[model samples]
Target: MSQSTAAGDAVQAMMRAVVVTRPGGLGALEIKEVPVPVRERGWVRIRVKAFGVNESEVTTRKGESDPEVTYPRVPGIEGVGVVDEADEDSGLRPGQQVATMMGGMGRTYDGAYAQYVSVPAAQVIPFETGLPWDVVGALPEMFQTAYGSLTTGLDLRAGQTLLIRGGTSTVGLSAATLAKDLGATVLSTTRSPDRTGELRDAGVDHPLTDNGTVADQVRELMPDGVDAALELVGCSVLADTLRTVRRHGTVCFTGALAGQWSINDFTPFMIPVGVRLTSYAGEAADLPADVFARQLEAVAEGRLRVPVAKVHHGLEQVQDAQDDVESGTAPGKHVVVLDD
Candidate 1:
């Protein structure tokens, strides 16, 4: 515990943070005391209370991600916290509640792995919430991806039929939940037969078990194909997902859990005519502040729920938490809680 300050001239404070000395194993997770970030014009510093562990972080930790991911970096992509310092023009005051995520976080720059993070004011979304820090921390990326993929990527609508290609995944389950909330008949799939119940509990109406040819299985239920689909498994299953939708229907490619990043033998004819194909990838700045704020409001009002699969206190368990998620044992979201 060291005393440090933000902006250097006025206040002083200190904070704890985790650093990845290099991309490797759990040994890379190093916790230490660091200076509280200094706020700049058009930027704000947050006192992080909690953060979420994402698979993207896992890839980065293993050195298998982008070459731009420099090591000895603080690795956190999303977090919930209070404003430690902000200029009035930032539209946030000290003590204001906000969440920080994506826009170059944990990759192009130092991110939320610290007790305090200074980020672009646009990337810090202000909101009102009484939810626990773990829950708030876990919601942004998963639900925002869920909401964006459907609302923007696929342009999903009420009374539509949606098939989540990899339903048991966190994002898949989140898509199912949001689609159901939008009045769609949600159908989801799982590679594990044992997890069908989990998908159903998450609001998936028709839970189908499939290893390959998931589209064939879907065809059995929806002979004319669904109204829309979200291909979560990536290229290996994308063609299958595309076929599961009717002519002129929509399909959004959002995830690549199957590890196939590119499509071989891909041709224009392979995609159905008039069948819209779209993808969603965004930074924190790309995510509308109003969208993030609305989700927080919905969760506080009990109109929505962001299920955290597990919550580990302190930065010490970050490695364990990431390993657990990599092992595919986490049921939903894994959150890391920090003391206020």
Candidate 2:
């Protein structure tokens, strides 16, 4: 066994983790005493301080994720912590603060739903911040998806008008703030008018209520159509979202919040002429360390907001966090914090 240290404290042989023996309800999540993960030559062991509950994890729990997930798995797609161990050449040192997400963290291997998790060194992003663990834990996956969708998927530029198809989702809110920071005009959608204030607080310039369709409402606000659109509600409304973009504008498919992943009777003709379509499913590397650091600073300075809906303490609350996420009662990121 390889012994490691976190912030000068000796790493324990056994750690508490949330283990899912099989896909089912929230009851499937079991807190167990498990052996601490050991890092290989190209891996780093993180002493997980906090993690965020996401819909992907919810799907994984319900046997709805990709087939790569196996039984006896720890489910967490994103986490923030201090390094407990690392290879000398891994460009990471013991005690370094870091954040990790995607790149098969939770599905193919044991993930961040533990006191410690070992992951590929290449997928780890080192960052420094004075913000609380709950705030930082909510960032990795949400920001990665939003940033990738806006920059890589859409190539959204300053002054461009952008529409977020699912404005109340965590990623949608993150996109609103990021687009605002880039000097873009944002028009977001919500199925309920009651949630428009959430979009406005996230920097959305206009919040349109979605009643199965909103292209006409979007067109009314921007006669020439928006310069870009982000589709999070899935394929059911994708065509309508595409209609809200200009002829040469782009639409980035990044989420399936409405639980619709595919479209029946789909045809290439569904896309408008000269309107490009793209998608973003990125990993930790998709988000740069400097950008993460800057955003954390922004949060600290009150220039940016992390819409954390709830924070649960310790591994015991993992079930509650997942339940809140599955219920969709919480409108923003749900986080779990582990205290020593």
Number of the top-ranking candidate, with TM-score as the measure:
2
Best by lDDT: 2
Compared with the true structure, what per-residue lDDT tens digits does model 2 show for residues 106-159? 899999999999999888999988888989999999998999899999999999
Candidate 2 local distance difference test against the native = 0.92
Evaluated at residue 337, the lDDT of candidate 1 is: 92
Taken over the whole model, the C-alpha lDDT of each candidate is 0.83, 0.92
lDDT of 1 by residue, 129-235 (tens): 78778788887778778888887788898998999988888888878877887889988999889899988888888999877877787788889889999988899
Model 2: per-residue Cα lDDT at residue 253: 96
Return the clash pairs for model 1, or none.
Answer: 3-13, 4-12, 4-13, 4-14, 5-12, 5-13, 103-284
Give stretches of model 2 more than 4 Å off. Answer: 1-12
Name the weakest run of 10 consecutive residues (lDDT summed) in model 2.
Answer: 1-10
Q: Could you tell me every candidate's TM-score relative to the true structure?
A: 0.93, 0.96
Q: How close is candidate 2 to the true structure, as a TM-score?
A: 0.96
